[model samples]
Target: MTDAFVAALPKAELHVHLEGTLEPEMLFALAARNHVELPWPDVEQARAAYTFTGLEHFLPLLFRAASVLRTRQDFYDLARSYLTRAAADGVRRAEMFLGVQTFLDAGTPIGDQLDAVLAAISDARTDLGIDGALIVTSQRHRTQAAALEVLELIEPWRDRLLGIGLGAAERGNPPAKFADYYATARARGYRTTIHAGEDGPPEYVREALDICRADRIDHGVAASADPDLMARLGDEAVPLTVCPLSNVALRVVPSMAAHPLPAMMAAGLLVTVNSDDPPYLGGYVNDNYQAVHTDLGLDRPALADLARNSFRASFDDPHRIAAHLAAVDAHVRANQPPERAYRAASAAR
Candidate 1:
C-alpha cells in the first residue's frame, strides 16, 4: 500500500537538509575523492552508526557525514544525488537546508561550497527537470553574531539563495536570540523559516512566528500541545513541516501512533509531511508519507490534502503552485483508495 501510494503522488519538500542527504555510499566516495580521512572503517560501518538517541547524539553523526564535503564539486554532487532520488520519489520541487557554518568552521572555502551547490541546483532544474532552491541555515548552537555573519556572507548571492534559516540544537538556542538576524533577512527581502518546537517547548514555536517572523515553521508538531498557539496557527494558516520518521528516529515522539499529525490536521493547522535527514533516518519523503498513512489511518483524500499543503507551502511561484496543486488533485482523482492499494500490496507480498 505504502509503495503504490507514493509511486503516483507528487509533492514539494520543505524541510530536507542537503547536507543530510549524504548517503553512506556517497560519504565514503567523497572522503576518498577529496583525500580526507573518515573515522568509520567502511561504508557499512558508517551506515550502522546512524543510531541516534537524541539531537545531541545525532548531530555528531551529521557533522561526520558532512566532513567529506570539502569541495564545490562535492557539494554539487551531493545536491545532484539528492534531487535525482527525490525526483524518483515524485518530488517536483525541493527547498533544501544547508548549514554553511559547518563548512566554514572546517576551513573550506565557502564559495567553493556555495558555488557548487547553487550550480547543482541549476543543473537539476535543466537536467532532471526538478526545481530546487537553497536556504542558508545558521547553526543555532552558534552565536547570533555568527548568524549575522552568515547573512552578510550570503548577501552577495541574494538572488540565488532563497532565504535565511535557523537549525541545529534547539534546547538552549531559543528563536528570540536571533531576532535581529531574522529582521535583517526580512529587511533584505528574503523569506525565513526556523527550527522550532521540534525538541523545544511550544513557546519556541510562538517566538519563531512572532519574534523571528518565520515565513514558515519547521517541525512545529509541538504547537499542538498549546491550544492558544494551535488556534493562532490555524487562524493564521501557518504551515508546519512535520517529519514523522525523523521524530521517531530522534525519539521526539514515543512512536508514530503518538505523533500528533492527525490531531494537528483536525485542529485546522496546515501540515505537510517531509523526510528530514532521510538517509540517516532510514526513509525518504515517500517513506514518511507511507508511515503516516498506515500509522495514522489516513486515506487517499487525507493523503491528497497533505500533498496539496506541500505545494501550497512551497516557495514556488504562485502560478507554479497552482499548477502543482492541480496535478495533485488530478492524481488523487485517478488513483484507487489506499485500502485497496494496501490489499494489492499484501497479495503481491
Candidate 2:
C-alpha cells in the first residue's frame, strides 16, 4: 500500500537503542555542547561513516557517536529527541533499550544518567502523550558480574523501568551467560528479554527461553533455518522483535527481499516490526513497517497483522494495549481502498 497509510497506522516500537538514535546533527551539537574531542571533523563525515559490514563493525561507530553524551541534559536531550521522533511516527508506546554501561564507563554518574532518562520519559508522556519506558540492557561482551551490577543500579529506579535485557554481539556471548542475571531480575518481578539468533545459532534461542526465561527474543530470525525451532517459537507464542532495515543494513540477510518475516508469519510466530537503530540505519518505526510492506509484497491485511502484533507484543498494560490494537483494526477497516470498477457508459463513449 501507500507509505501515508502505513504512517497513519498506530504501533509500538520495542527494539530501539537510545545510543543508536543519535542523529549526526545531534551528535555534533552535543559534542560542541559537551566539549568532547572527536575523530570526525564534521557532521557529513560522521554520517558517511555509518557504512558497515556487520554488527561487529557497527559497535565502534555506536560508541563513537555515544561519546558526546556527558551530562544529564545530554542524556535527556538524546532521549527526548528519540521520543519526539517516535511520537511523530505514530508510536503510541516506545519500549527503548538503554545499555547504561555506556554512560557509566564514560564516567557519567549513574544517578545522573537514571534521573535524566526518567525525566525524558516523563516529558514524552506529558508533552507528546506517548508512553515511554526504558528496558535497562547490559552489554553481553562484559562479565555476568557487570550485568548484576547494572541490575543493582536499576533496583532503586525500578519504578521508572519496564524491564531488564541483554544485548550486544550474539556470537561469543550466549544468552545463558546471564542466567543468574535474568533470574535476579525475574525474582524482582522485572519483565525480561534477551538478544538471540541475530548472529548466533538457533540453539541460543532455546537458551534464551529455557535458561534465561526471557519474555521475548530480539532478532530471533535465525529460527527460520530450523523447522523445529520455528515450531517451538510459534507454539510458545514468543514475540520476536524483528528489525528488517537494521538486519539488511548490517547484512544479517542479503536484503529486505530475503528477510524471513513472511516465513515467520507463515509459521504463526508473533512477530513485531521495529527500528533497532533508526538514525544510524535510517528510518523509525513507521519507516520499518512501510519498508517490510513493500519488500515482502505484503497487502493491507498483512500490514495490519504486523501493526496489531506491535501492540500485542508490547509491555503496556491491558487497557492501553487493547485501545491501541482496536485503533489499528479500525484504521485497517477504514483505509483498505476499493479496486477499480468498470463504467459501462464511459466505456461505450
Candidate 3:
C-alpha cells in the first residue's frame, strides 16, 4: 500500500510494553507527583540518555523511570495516555505488556497496579474506542518463583489480561529459566510469548518454544543465524514481533537499513513490525513501519503484508481481525500504481 494508506490502515499491536511507552515528559511529571528523584533534571537530558549501547545499558534506566509510578492513578494515567496515542495511530486493538516485576521491585502492590491499569484500559475502550488487553511479563533476570508470583497476582484479572511473557535481559537467563511458570500459565489457558534471539542466540528461541511453550517469539532476530530454527518458525507459523527502532537504538543491529526484518519475511516467518519501547526508542508503531520500509527498501505489497501480519498475529477476536484485514486489502487495492507505490515507499524510507 501507499505510505499514507499504510499509516491510515486500522491495526493491532501484539507486542508493546506499557512501561516502555513512558515519554520523558510523563516521567518527569509522574516523578514530581510521586516525590521521586530523577537523575536527569530536564527532559532533554533524559532524552539524551536514551542512546544505549545495548539492552543491559537500557534496563537500569527503564527500571528507574518506572520508580516514579507509585500510585494507582499513576498507572491509570500512563495506560490511558498510551491507549489514546495508539488510537490516534490507527491502532484499534492492542495487547500491551506490563512489567509487574518492576513495580514489585519498587515496593508497589501488584494488585493495585493491575487493578488501576486494567480499569484504565476498560475506560479507554469505552471512551476512546481503543480495545486493549494486558500481558503481565516476568523479568527473565529474576527467579522463576518471582514470575509465578506475578501470575498468581494477576489471576483475578485473567479475563482482561491476555497472556504471560518473559522480557527484560535475555542474555544469560534463557527461556528454560521460566519454563515452569510459562507451563503453568499455559495450563491455566493464558497465551504465551517470550523475548528470545534479540540479544540472545537462536537456542534461546528454541527453548522458548520447546521448554516455555511460547506461542509467539518477540525479537527473534538472531534466528537468521540458524537455518533449522528459521525453518521451524516458518513451518510452525509462529509470529515474531520485530522492533526496528528498538533494535537500532540498543545496537542489536548496526542500523535500521541492516535489519533482518525483510529477510525474516522472505523466509516465510510471520514477521510483524512493532515498537518495543517507542518514546524511549525514538519512535512509535508507525515510525517503526516507516523506518523499516525506508531502510529495507520494502515495496507496497511487502508493507501490506507486514500490516496484514500484525492483525493476523494479534490475539484480537477473529471478527475484529477480519475487519482490519479488509481495511488493509481495500487500501492496497486502491493504491496499486507500482511506480507511485515505489516513490511513496522511497519517501517513507
Q: Write the per-residue lDDT of candidate 2 for residues 1-349, one digit (tens) a residue.
A: 3388788888899999998899989999999998998889998988888888999999988987898999999989999999998888888999999888988999998888878988999988999989999899999999999999998887888877899999887799998899999999999989998999998899999999999999999999999999999999999899999999999989889989999999999889999999999878757888788888887888778888988898889888999999999999778757755432234334557
lDDT score of residue 96 within candidate 3 = 93
- Angstrom error at residue 85, model 2: 0.7
Clashing pairs for model 3 are 294-349
RMSD of each: 4.5, 4.1, 4.3
For all candidates, the clash counts are 0, 0, 1
Cα-based lDDT for every prediction: 0.90, 0.89, 0.88
For residues 1-349, what per-residue lDDT tens digits would candidate 1 score against the true structure?
4567676698999999999989999999998998889989998988889887988899988997798898878888999999999888889989999999999988877788789989988998998888999999999999999999988888878988888789999998899999999999999989999999999999999999889989999999888889999999999999889999999999999899999999998988889999999999858999999998888888778888999999989877999999999999778655867796687668889
Instruction: Give the Å error, residue 337, model 3.
Output: 4.1
Tens-digit lDDT track for model 3 on 1-349? 3268557767778879999899999999998898899999799999988889999999998988889998899999999999998888878788899998888878889877999989999999999988899988989888999899888888888877889898999899989988789889998999989999999999999998898888889999999888999999999999999988899999999988888888898899999988899988858888888777777888778888988999999887899889889988878867768887788778889
Q: What are the models' TM-scores?
A: 0.95, 0.95, 0.94
State which candidate has the highest lDDT: 1
Candidate 1 residue-wise lDDT at 326: 92
After superposing candidate 3 on the true structure, give the runs of residues whose Cα lies further than 4 Å from its correct spot: 1-3, 337-349
Q: Candidate 2 has which clashing residue pairs, if any? A: none
C-alpha RMSD between model 2 and the true structure: 4.1
